[model samples]
Target: MPVWRRYLVRDASGRMVELPSRALDKAEDGTSPIPGFAGRCVDVVAAVLVAERGQSPQVAEVSFTKLYFDKSGFVDTGKRERMIRLMLESVADKRLARIPNAARAEAAVRAGAARLQLADEFAWQPGPAEMNEVMLRLDHRPAGQGHTVH
Candidate 1:
């Protein structure tokens, strides 16, 4: 199996499938009805981040591959999406900001995921009221600790 195949997850019907190109196009072009990232389709994007932005491959793989497996060691797409949204909501901006254009890339990932309907995950953007809270939280964290938040 290819490295990317390791990131595939089974849906509610126990069906595991690759992300189709049409869905990818829809996500990339902003034609989808929702605004979120597809959890299972992020392997390529993660690879690109590592290749272009100097992000560590091991770091990217470890951070993303966790989304595909369940507590029982089975492939599960069910809650993987929730994890993705939580990652975005909690610390993605601060944690990934050092990587240039990381935010936009991540947003696109989320949008594409949403478009594919592979997972129910949605992208999160802090509102005006929440921005201050988010900034405050980020301001308190130390830098370059070399720990993956999610």
Candidate 2:
């Protein structure tokens, strides 16, 4: 199994309200939409915070964004792609518009899981320099030792 560590910034009130990074790719379910920092990674983190805190805070509303892709390693591409697609679809189809802030955060996690799945599909074949370049350019840290973010 592979995992991606997601970083996020939030305020004292704890509302998910920031887009830290942009999507590198676009999937049917809109997993990684936009090529730059303009998505909902922060929402995912907010959901996590809400879960951890076990109650809503007084923080103002915040947007979720992806700061970077902290990769664990490459696994099965086929499975990853399928998972990402499924997760995105699930989140997209859900009635999030009416959901509470905490629920919306959970939805972001589901969506992120799918995105991570797609990322895991890539093969580990890039050099350190190349990987560094991706990290510097996109804030994406490759997962595997020799893997690079594409």
Best by TM-score: 2
Question: 105-130 in candidate 2: lDDT tens per residue?
Answer: 88877867655554444223334553
Query: For candidate 1, what is the lDDT?
Result: 0.37
Position 74, candidate 2: lDDT: 20
TM-score of each model, paired residue for residue = 0.22, 0.24
Candidate 1: deviation at residue 106, Å? 27
lDDT of 1 at 126: 31
Each candidate's lDDT (Cα)?
0.37, 0.38
* Winning candidate number (lDDT): 2
Off by over 4 Å in 1: 1-9, 32-89, 92-150
Give candidate 2's TM-score: 0.24
- Model 2 / residue 31 / CA error / Å: 29
